[model samples]
Target: MSFINFNFEPSLQEGLDAMGFDRPTPIQEMAIPVIMQGKDLIACAQTGTGKTAAFVLPILNKISKSGSNKLNTLILAPTRELAIQIDQQIQGFSYFLGVSSVPIYGGGDGIVWEQQKKALETGAEIVVATPGRLIALLAGGKMDLSTLEHLVLDEADRMMDMGFSDDILKIVNYLPQKRQTVLFSATMPPKIRQFSMKFLHNPEEISLSIGKTAEGVTQSMYSVYDGQKEELVRHILSQKAYESVIIFASTKDKVKALYKVLRKEFDIEAFHSDLEQLEREKIMSNFKNKAVKILIGTDIISRGIDVVGIELIINYDTPSDPEDYVHRVGRTARADKEGEAITFVNPKDQHKFVRIESLIGMEITRNPMPEGFERGPEYLGEKAKSSGFSSGGDGKSKNKKKKKPGNKPAGEKRNSESGFKPRADFKNAPPAHKQEAPKQEAKKTEPSDTPKSETPSKYGQRKNVIDS
Candidate 1:
């Protein structure tokens, strides 16, 4: 339906017009009216369905009409990436109105802390913050939200996953008990439903199907040995000279390790906890601006990043969580545009991939192993064996004749780092820099480890967000 049906204020309508936002998305259509009616809501919508605008629009409209800007609303997000994104959207959607917002997150320069404190001390209609940083501010008594009119929990499931439940409950305790509370998430696990009872007041529940991937995504998979991963990455990126690509790796160490190896061959950067806050922001800005073509990062960016026109997403590593697969793949094929998502599944992660397949309700096209590479596992589903860092495996290690016990003193425990063996080349990769590390986020001080960035879901069935 058209946005006009919402009867948004003239100023609000002007902002939507200036931004070319005409019709409402399904979630927006369902939620705007509930939020406008002052009813609490719990919405389940996946990434890339215009969920941001769903809550942002009505809140802005209501806050604008109220005319009093005394810390009217507080939005809690899981990451700094999402907090910034939501605040930016607030600015865009409230352009013609008097709504003001401040994003409270940590890890930036001291100047950022000062800016957040000042904005809250004076006046802001809305405040979007991460749990950790917001707690810091509240502990310091930096802002008074006793007059707060609304509270929103965006990416509710993610915040719960990232260990923010306690912090969220604490933050809520500071807000007025009578305020309108809204919750939005991509999934509704048992925990989410149980947690809502604590705060929601007869909240209206809206669930659009869960684990549903977008139609435009073209999804595919590859079963390769551990050593074959880097080679597969090169092959995929080379196949279509992708202008904008994201490689999802697991941890900060992995992100850095991958960046070092791929730097000379492509325009790439690493996004992880190691970089300075400004550097992270700069890298994200470059990606959105198309100056940086390839971004490799951990799940830190899995929920909130929203860069459209992303051409490719390579799950340099598969995610343990099936829902994350949806988020990573959702990055591509956004806004009804087509995109591709490719995943690399080693023997150890084959079962995880299988669960993802089940969650999405379809088997992904399995691309054959490249000509020179060794043949991979035989699609063994949950029976897939987890292998060590071996160069070649026919995926039948379980059938091999049991090897005689290794030479060792009787009853002597395996050395401290037993199963954690690494390739000789990457053995010293992580520790080499960690031992000599400078103290802080110097932007380059990093200890590289094994890689794992699995971009979030969107469609032609491939690509990335912290919230995209």
Candidate 2:
């Protein structure tokens, strides 16, 4: 049905018209009515499913009906990015309603707090914040929530994952005991269910496409050796179809490395916890403007970033956690646009791929490696030996002999002929046993460096380049 069917205020309708949102998403269609009836809600939907609007619309309606300009609503989000995003949505929906909303989170100047204090002083209607910063402000006697009429936990599972349960409970304790409570999560793990039971009062439960990837996204995986992931990533970027892409890696180092490699050919940016607040904002702004064509980041950018027109998401490294795979892919195919999610599956990470497929209830099609894309020797078989460096396995590397305590003496041993040498004390130490020849060591090379000297250069020169 059309948004007009929802009977929203003219102001909100105008804002929707401006945003070109003609209708409600499934979650919104099911949730807005129940929420408008003032019932608590527990919603389960994947990211990019209009979950934010589900609650924001109803909250705006309630505020408009009551016309109580006091601090009537509190929305707690897991990250600063999410907090800001929800706040922006609230502002968008309440654009003409004269409902004041403030977003409070870390990394911004205390200027936000000053604005929050002023808004509270002048009767702000909604306050969106990260739990930690919100609770701190409340405890410091700078903010009051006694008159709070509604409470919303956005991305509840992510909050728990980020260790905000205690802060959430504390924040709840500070709010009025009888306020309307709502919880939304991409996935409802047992912990989320437990939290919902503790907080919500006879909540209306809505599950839309539970544990599934967004329908608009085209999901696929590539089977490549672990060593050749960089090569595959480069090949994918070489295609002109992807206007903007976000590549997710499992670790900060990997994010930086991928960003460095991609930046050589395209405008690329990196986002991770290590970046300062200003730097992160700058990078995000650049990415949204398409000044940066590729963004290599950790899971931080997966959930809350609401940038539109992202054409593809590349999982340079398959997420070890199955839930993260969903979030990473969710970055694309947002709203109604079609998007593609390509994952690089090394042989050893097949189990993780299986777990993701099982959770999402769909097999990610395995396509042949792109032409000229080299699969490393390690990925030749169905299952490769664990790399041991990060995979936590002891194979050939662990089987190597350990030097005996007395095998080599403490001081330098002068040889009879040579000036200095390793003492040949093993003569009587043990029998001369046949040992397998040592495996050839893979060259110690940076990911940004050319795997082969003749590989075409994305950068001007064919010189060795180190990953950041």
Residue by residue across 1-468, what tens digits does model 2's lDDT show? 998988987767877898788989899999999888889999999989899999998888777777776788899998877876787677666656777776677654455445455545655678888887787788878877888889999999889999999999898888898889999999988878987798789888998877888888999888666556665665566556455889888899888677655554456677887665656767787888977667888888988999888999999888988898988888888887889999887656766787888899987786865533333324332233333335422122221122333444423222222222222321112112312455354333211100122454232221111100
How does model 1 fare in lDDT? 0.77
Q: Write the per-residue lDDT of candidate 1 for residues 1-468, one digit (tens) a residue.
A: 899999999988988998898888788999999999999999998788889898888988887787775678899999888988998788788777756777778775555566667667666778889899899999998878889888999999999998999998899888888899999999899999999889999999999868877788899998776566765676566555567888999778878888876664566778988776666778889999987778899888778999889888889888999999989988887787888888988777887888898999998999987644456656666566453535344343331111234623423312222221122231113233543777463545332211122553222111111112
Off by over 4 Å in 1: 385-468
Model number with the top lDDT: 1
Score candidate 2 by lDDT.
0.73
TM-scores of all candidate predictions against the true structure = 0.83, 0.79
